[model samples]
Target: MTRCRLCGSEALESVVDLGATPPCESFLAADQLDLPEPAYPLHLRVCTGCWLAQLPPLITPEETFREYAYFSSYSASWVEHARTFVAEAVRRLDLGATARDAFVVEVASNDGYLLKHVVDRGIRCLGIEPSVNVGAAARDAGVPTLTAFLDPATGAAVRAEHGPADLVVANNVYAHIPDVVGFTRGLRALVADDGWVSVEVQHLLTLMAENQYDTIYHEHFQYYTVGSAIRALASGGLALVDVEPLPTHGGSVRLWARPAEAVGGTADGAPPARTTAGARGRVADMLAREKAAGLQELSGYAEFSARVAKVRRDLLRFLVDAADRGATVVGYGAPGKGSTLLNHCGVRPDLLPYTVDRNPYKHGRFTPGTRIPILPPERIAADRPDYVLVLPWNLRTELLAQLSYVHAWGGRLVFPIPELSIVEVKP
Candidate 1:
């Protein structure tokens, strides 16, 4: 029996199956083309005991993140998000004149997209990044980064060197770890008595209710709910004092946690509320709603898979029809969820042609499994494809606004997931 990673519960149920896929960031090299690509079963299961949603075990961190190709500096929206988060954190923490000299550390700090803002204020910031390539990029950007994973041992080492941190920020990387207990313990060890650890992860309740099974890749080991997160933190001697909901990555939750001994505060002192109720209360309502919507029924997921297949058929027809009419169809945003959608839907270069990304590291590389070449976003403006598929559909509004220039050529934007639709731009 597969035990729960958080609560050691064996009462688990298979929720959704994403089929076999390669690691989203495993871009291929030219010489490695002939080698057989490694694919693993990508399935999600929910622990009935603690209500923690997670994927079945297959790959390890060493196998997944040794030389990670993803860099956070690529996304314009993400950079802005980080900058805003730093401003809020500094204000909420009440760090005034000392803010310039206060210590801030980020776990799984991919390329220091957020930490750079902290350093810009003259604050002493440190980044713990496991991927050597990504860590080196952060160092190049003038952010001090340690090339190692955040574990109990590593956390102790960091505390001995840099002392306790006033702020510990980990964004989007919270759900990618397998050892939930160890990871939380490391957070407890590194944080100061009054310091807070902020974690942002995609909310599980939203993923299931919205049919966002494409986010069930191997790298994301766990999907969190407020209840599950609170329990996990308490078990590791940490307290979750506040939470905030964010619209990024479909739907996500940003949690503010401090040592168990620290006193808690009210919602007014926390980040802006994104839901009608507080984070925990909103999560409870969502969980109850999901159960009422038959989330536990396996047939619900079967129907979801059917909807996905229909999307694939409709999108394929559109792309092929466009190509026959002498129009080029390309894709935008090479995100992890986009990789799952592209590979599972069987989209190849013959159909989608190529994809463009803002990340320079991924510009010359090919996506895993599909092997479709990735180019810089400038290629889209130059090539002027008749249709550009926005893979990260949640950011449709943001992406459309940025790529509005496509309307200059009478080109349209296409969205595949949650149904295939061609957007009409208002002149």
Candidate 2:
């Protein structure tokens, strides 16, 4: 029996099965154009004991992130999101005058998107990034970065060199590690006696309720709920004291944690009885709702898969009909989840023609399995396809706003997940 990666519980029930899919980032090479692609089982399961949602094992970090291609700097929205996070974090930590020279460390810091904001305030910062290409981008952006994965040993080295961090930020990367307990322990070791660690991860409850099963790829080893996160941190000598909901990446939670002794003590060395009751209550309610929805049953996922198949059929029918009418259809946003959706629906070059991505590195490459070429977003304006399919449907509002120019040509936008529909642009 497959056991839960977090709590080692054998009580895992299949939540969704996306069938065989290529690796999310395995963009194809030109020379291997005709080579058949390999697909792995894309399945999600929930641990009954800890309430962690995760995919059945496929790839490891060494295989996935060693020379990663995705860069955070490519997305304007993501850059703005990082800036906002830095501002809020600095204010909450009271680092303006008191800790002017305080050190801030970010684990899995992608392309120095967040660190640039912290360093602009004259705060000393370091970024630990495993991807060489992305780490180089961080350095180019004037952020000091170490190209290595964060672990207990690396944490010790960082402390010996840069001193303990006053604040540590890990965004959207908390679920990427296989040894999650060990990773949290490393964060505990690097944090100052009074320092705080903040991590943002996709919310499991939202993933299930919204039928976001496509996000369950091999790179994400564990999906976290606040209850499971608190337990995991407590095991590593840390405590979660606060939670904030963020709208980025479908739905996510920003968790604030610190060493157990750091709580109930002020920066001025006084005891305070502050509590995070509101955040805790919100999280508890979400967990209860998930349990009531039968998240622990295999039948629940079978129904979900059935719905997904219906979406696939409907999308294919629409695309075939559009093609019959000589309507050109192309895809926007070559996101990881977009890859999952494309593969699950058996989309090929004949259906999508090509796709456009904001990331320059992904441009000029072909998507795996489908072999659909990825071009720059500018190509959308130049080509002016009859219908533009927004694969990352969660970002429909943002994408539609950005691509409003299509309206001038009387073009319509299509959303292919959850359902296939042509949406009218609202003024």
Candidate 3:
């Protein structure tokens, strides 16, 4: 983009160029193998003024989320993670099972993975999701989901119908929207004046530190450090109150915010007593860590491109070596990040052969730009390859256990991000 999406600043600096790739989620059908696939530049730029790293809005959300292929409940760990978050939110917010006024709302609530926990507690909850397929799954599971993107108008209408929500939850979706300010305002519109809004997004600090460049894609329009997040929240009339570091999605931050007036003060009283002691200190500490890591300036990003290059080189080398030795190599998951990693490294079906996933929707499809066939998870056990490349390395622990059966056939699992590492599994 010519100017920053967040601050409209022209002082954008190159962070890393991941070359061009098709929208990561656009899996191809067998009938369309010969059809032309469009690709876009997947370069990342950071605005010096705002320090928000972003990709140009090459593709729209409508193209991706309308009939999304991803289903959140497929991953057992993620489902449990959502369960835990729901319980914690309910307790932390003092939401009562029988309280007639208590209500919760989640934006981009995929497949009711988290809201189902809210449903179990007998607390009234609603999920505002954009994907028709996933939203149908949510409703089937008994979560009240509205299939619509969260803009100011939609949020207001939801508020009008359901009344103001006591708690608004947004997880792993803050970076998905191009209109950051408008989305934040939508959060503001849905929440009660004194209610809370919680957002979870991958932290730019951890992404750079761990070489998680594969997470960068067109759908994720922006990345945030706490410093940049605080500024972005202010743009849509929200105040940052707390921040929590999470281990989900490689690394993430849970941001707790409220209406600007709620944090500052109400008209009739001083600021409502909140968790100022712990939250303010944590926010300060995280910001300090970001600055010390040089993320607030250009120094921290200078070597990122070099580091990303090494990952691609190492992975390609491994695949080539395996092919040369007549050893079969395959892939484990067909996640969006996997598409970025595969396309960036120029890995095609000849090297990868095929990848397997538990999601049936993608079983007969191909990865967006890489065209690697996606098969069912059973394919791995049926034709155990010498090595299996684990593309969704962020779920390392869970996947390790899930694929441990490969050990029966002397198979190995390869992880490509944060550095290349091959592990011998124990069945």
Instruction: Choose the strongest candidate by TM-score.
Output: 3
lDDT of 3 by residue, 178-227 (tens): 99989988999999998999999999999999999999998999999988
Clashing pairs in 2: none
Off by over 4 Å in 3: 97-100, 265-275
Query: Mind sharing the TM-score for model 1?
Result: 0.89
The TM-score of candidate 3 is 0.97
**Cα lDDT for residue 131, candidate 1:** 94
- Select the stronger candidate by TM-score from 1 and 2: 2
lDDT by residue for model 1 (1-427), tens: 3899988999888766678999887888777778999998887777877777888768888887888878888778889999999998888876445524578899999898999998897888899999999899999999999998888898889999999988988888878888888888888888888788899988776776666767778899998876677777776667666667788888888887877766542222222233234654654555465566555444434456566567668877898898899888899988888888888888899988899988787877888999999899999989988889998888877787888989888888998867788985544
How far off is model 2, as Cα RMSD? 3.7
Error of 2 at 210 (Å): 1.6
List lDDT for all candidates, in order: 0.80, 0.80, 0.91
lDDT of 3: 0.91
Which regions of candidate 1 are displaced past 4 Å?
99-101, 263-307, 320-326
